[model samples]
Target: MKSLQKLATIALAIILMGSCTAQEEATTLKDALKDYFYIGTALNVPQVAGQDPQAIEIVKTHFNSVVAENCMKMMYLQPEEGVFFWDEADAFIEFAEANDMQVIGHTLVWHSQAPRWMFVDENGDQVSRERLIERMKTHVQTVVERYKGRVHGWDVVNETILDDGSWRQSPWVRIIGPEFVQMAFEFAHEIDPDVELYYNDYSVSRPEKRDGIYNMVKDLIDNGVKIDAVGLQGHLSMDFPTVEMKEEALQKLASLGVKVMVTEMDITVLPWPSRRHSAEVSLNYEISDEYNPYPNGLSEESYTALMDKYVDFFEMFMRNKDIISRVTVWGVDDNQSWRNNWPIRGRTDYPLLFDRDYQPKSAVTRIIELANAKKQ
Candidate 1:
């Protein structure tokens, strides 16, 4: 009886060891990032106190590439004229380089998030067209020269086209006019001939927006603009954007010889307010109002729906890998998502693959399942 008990103990130990091994080999978010396709998240220097080793751990474990700083641009890189802030970006780039991760520079020129002094004159009015172009060229050169080969690619222009295929009435258009995007790409190429340049924007799934970006890229490429790719900032919602629209957008962009990327992807559960009803229209339905609770936050069902929505998009991404190059979730987890504000205003939104505690949610599991489907 004693001998039998000893054998049973040995068998239990073996089983426990096997379980541990399986857990250790479990695919991480980083593993999913590297194995099937690119996965990424944004980093805020101030929030991380510039010692974000966890960010590196995430990339090392999951991702092959990352979109760095709004780096290589006006807002974060050169917050003040000729005053470069390399302290944070320097650490991030070095971290990525040492860890064998590729970094994509966010933007050289954009309507939003740029330093106030960039477009405005000493009088605080729009600068002249020629003056704006020179400023843009200077900003682009200073940034691209600093990071030339270290960063892999850049969003030379961002959000220049509106959802309805019209040009946004940005101060950029008022000052630099239509030449802003073209000159931005030109300046990037001048600095680093090898680094790819792309035009990036949100709402690529909308037919009008997709067609508009396609036309814009076609013209830029035709005009010798060295534009190598287009970034589809896939900030999706619970249900509106049909996957058919997304697939069509990819094929259309691919047809133009430009690579497409699902940049800034986060599907918010907060019910996307119906375009049919104006913003002034108060939420009458209980489901819509609770999902988009004005003062407090998202309901529990809204949070679950958000995760399921992300899974659906990843499933679509799996099916359409040929045209998609990089897939970046804007933030790492729920607490960090932009959906907390902006649209929903004062809502506790859960939008990414990880929950607020940094635990991988079912969204992460579904992503892995979709990515590993072929192996199964």
Candidate 2:
């Protein structure tokens, strides 16, 4: 029976691989990592709605998991209070289902991209703690209930902890208190008891913030919250957060007895800016040739440097795949990545496994080769 079950997993993988007539079946990221963890990519509205043929091809062929990059966020889904937009969110889930892929609902709660109405009343007064909690419950219930069993997990809360291990003091904390995190998780769980819940943050690999997350999650687990995973937002760069830093983080988060996922994984190969370490949505800079050095193109030396960096990270991920349920590149390819406009408005960044042309980078091939070789 065990042998038969292994055969079944392979057979299903092949069917998902589909047919390649003119050539032998092409090697894919998902297939290579099937025995390790789910390989996933993020989708914007274009790909979710079947508009980007190139990204759709990559999603269907190389990825078995998908996350909505923006469509499922609070501002996009509920730009105004009591009125929700379901078109893009629904289309996102539908796309995943149609492709036989697992869906990770990007986020159910976040301080960034949240509607301004959520924290205040019509009179422009900050809502009371009780009032805000009710609002949160309603929002989570409506959204989580809509996609209950379809999604593998949700980043139930995002970026609430600071790098110094202090709470960020976002309006949620000011009004709803630290328990806001717990409430959001509870609300999501109440709607779908089966869905996995995650606490996601960036800069969590730093020991100071890592200890902060550990203590916060330990309290929640001790209180019997349904926390299933901790998302290490691996928004990496060519140099920041050494491999040892991440490896230690992986083991520390796993100590909590919950699975770890390298959510929102991307490695920007551009020059670092002032706010070099944070993925703050508000971080922006005026572009100059200094930061935007690669606007024309990446040099051979720079490209090889980026490739080596990716290989190092992927190797670490593979080593710790037992506790890592998924490793998702933040975008489909270079052209679609948010890094291009992030930190600086007009800098070019090569961050993902695929290039601007939708061709898989040599780094991707190397990672796939390493994965296959390990399994063999």
Candidate 3:
């Protein structure tokens, strides 16, 4: 059975490869990618200086959009509850607008990095469902209204779905239940009426997670909520669920009439089964122990393997560009990636197009090639 599965995976990959023959005809990687992909990256607020000029230039030369400074919803945007702060976000918004770059708002409501002041009873636990809904409505209305036309889209909610395909135990979820996702979207739509709204989550490359998103979005669509796209936060490891699963999930979501975007793509190369890692990384449910090793940083061979995986996945996406809209990297460089302490702590992780020194990685070159290749 395992052998047959391998055969089938290869067979399907071959068919996809044949269908993506444009990858072969492209003379240069950049030329090919420009035609098929929207290559963009997230920017840190502090790093947007002398570095930003060069970084934005590189992006303008190669990509189309920019995901602004983690834009952590109303809490960060309006830390004083009603008072909104756009000083940092404005720098990016204005920069992108000045450069004619598309802008994607990182998130509106999320489980993590939420302001501590959001939902607190007098005792400081959390607000009730009723209060939470009001907060959601107010936050969405205020911020979305401020940037209604300038902002291209909002990650209406981020990481509300867990790795096990269950709704996260967020304050919003604990109080508002499943309706929170719908309410978030409705409020955003009512406020902007124009900005594209998406539900963004990590590990969407997994089948269960992808299916969870599909089910939720489909339900929202059936209930008459306006959801525009799904952002697959493609934070990948060296060896994990094949892109085949990711592709299948994207196709299914597309069938639901929602656009798909590779929102936060980064491939982390970490040592396998390292004692310092947690049960999640050690268990290798998503990847075999043999495929990963300890001292979990990306090795030369692992980098190459991961790059190939990216090529295969993007080829699949290019073939389906009719539904998938953008391909965004979580960070501009490896040094900026969150993978350093995530999934594996204290271990160095190389997970972006550019290295810590801001030099382009070979993976970036190959991805460009895949993106540029014309369809056969």
The lDDT for every candidate, in the order shown, is 0.73, 0.88, 0.74
**Candidate 1, residues 1-376: lDDT per residue as tens digits?**
9999999999999999978865655376556545456777665554335454554455456566776534445688878877878877776677678767778888788877789888778998877888878888888898888887898888888888877887877888876677777888888898899998899887777788889888888988899889887888877766657677777888898899888888887776665645631111123432344655533544668666776677777777766777777888787667666667645455667777666666677777777756655434
For candidate 2, lDDT tens digit of each residue in 152-262?
899999999998999989999999889999999999998899999999998778999999999999999999999999989889987788888988988898999999888
All candidates: TM-score: 0.83, 0.92, 0.82
Using TM-score as the measure, the top candidate is 2
Q: Cα deviation of 77 in candidate 3 (Å)? A: 1.3
Q: What TM value does model 3 have?
A: 0.82
Rate residue 191 of model 1 by lDDT: 83
Q: Give the distance in Å from residue 173's predicted Cα in candidate 3 to where it truly belongs.
A: 1.4
CA shift of 137, model 3, Å: 1.0
Top candidate on lDDT is 2
lDDT of 3 by residue, 1-376 (tens): 9999999999999999877774456543334555565667787776554455665556666556788756545556878666788888778788788777788887888766677777786688778878878877988887788778998889998887766678877788888898999999999998888899998876776667777878889899999999999888777665664678778778888899889888877776665555322223223234444533534455677777867776777777788778888888877766667776665445567777777676777766776655543543
Worst lDDT 10-window in candidate 1:
277-286
Clashing pairs in 1: 30-61, 30-62, 31-62
